[model samples]
Target: MSTVTTATNATTTHRSARSVARRTAWLAGALFWSAFAVLEAVNHGWLAGTLALTFFVLPDLTFLVALDDAPRMAKGQLPPCAVPYYNALHRALVPLALLVAYTVQPFFAWAPLFAALCGWMAHISYDRAFGYGLRTKEGFQRG
Candidate 1:
């Protein structure tokens, strides 16, 4: 094979590896969260556990709806703002805010605040584990 062909093949293989690794990481994260939610439900109750799972997965859902690059940037549509709106939901502050609210009130008949907090943490962990760090205003993929 020509040098150019060899380089292209290497690049394609690298990208394929990265894609596979990313997908695997995502699958692992999903399994982890599902197991956690199930265990929580078994210990607590169904409603609270489901709520926790929903909160845990909320950031990704919001990102898919609002800030994902494929539907926006790939289509040549500029984002309305420099920072992606999803970043706001993905930060540690989300869980901190939940913690503060729980501290202030401490009253819950169902769906404890801890579940939401755990969900936020799980989201962050999954992103970090999968190498999906925070996106900068400059591009779709950045720390």
Candidate 2:
């Protein structure tokens, strides 16, 4: 093969490896956080379980905020107005920060909010594992 072809192949291989690593890491995070949420529910009470389930499904509901704009968006694009809410919920740091705060100083009786954070993190992790991520300001998935 020519040098250019070899270089292209190498770059592609490197990117493929990085993608696989990223997906694998996110998958692991999903599994761990999901399991932790489940355990919290079992150990705590119905409120913990309910909050966990709620937060798990809450992030995607941001789409409803701009449902009327969907018709004008490009394929696979979120509505621009909903992008901020979607990006905010999909950010792992948000839940991670809350989790750290809970650990440092418990609140909401600890278990329910903790479980919710775990579920939220699990949702984000699963999205990342499946190659979904925060959108750009224009609502397209960031490359």
Candidate 3:
């Protein structure tokens, strides 16, 4: 193998380690918040729970998307198409889903808080499994 290839491989491996460390810490935090959401949902019944799930869980996931973009974009990538993507998840998809699940749904209604909470968890889990969020010698981009 060539020297450059070897060095590149080593760097990639090292970066992967750093990324995983960052991702792990991030995921741990998400888990804590997700747990809080679940507990709150249980207590609040529906409306409050739904709000809490969106307010709490969405941020947790959006963070992962931020993390994923770090290596590619040195600039803080705050979900470039975030508003549209977020709308799809929180507004269009979720409400429609809720309507299908429980008919006679009312406006200003809270859907399944558990489902929203799960959505957040899914993001964290997906990053942990696939993100390879490694820190590089270039270091993390600072805002």
Task: Kindly list the per-residue Cα lDDT of model 2 for residues 1-143, writing each as its tens digit.
Answer: 69999999999999999999999999999999999999999999999999999999999999999999999999999999999999999999999988888888745457889999999999999999999999999999998
| lDDT of prediction 1 | 0.64
Off by over 4 Å in 2: none
Q: Report the CA-based lDDT of candidate 3 relative to the real structure.
A: 0.51
Candidate 1 C-alpha error for residue 77, in Å: 10
lDDT of 2 at 76: 92
- lDDT by residue (61-126, candidate 3, tens digit) is 534544655466545344443334433443323533553554454552444544454445444444
Per-residue lDDT for 1-143 in model 1, tens only?
Answer: 69999999999999989877876776676566556656666777766677777877777654444454545464433343534655776676667666567667747324445665666666775776666766666436562
Superposition error at 38 for model 3 (Å): 1.7
Cα lDDT for residue 41, candidate 1: 67
Better of 1 and 2 by lDDT: 2
Candidate 1 lowest-lDDT run of ten:
74-83
- After superposing all C-alphas onto the true structure, candidate 3 shows an RMSD in angstroms of 12.9
Ranking by lDDT: 2, 1, 3
Candidate 2's TM-score = 0.95
How close is each model in CA RMSD to the real structure? 6.6, 1.2, 12.9
Best by TM-score: 2
Q: What is the lDDT of every predicted structure here?
A: 0.64, 0.95, 0.51
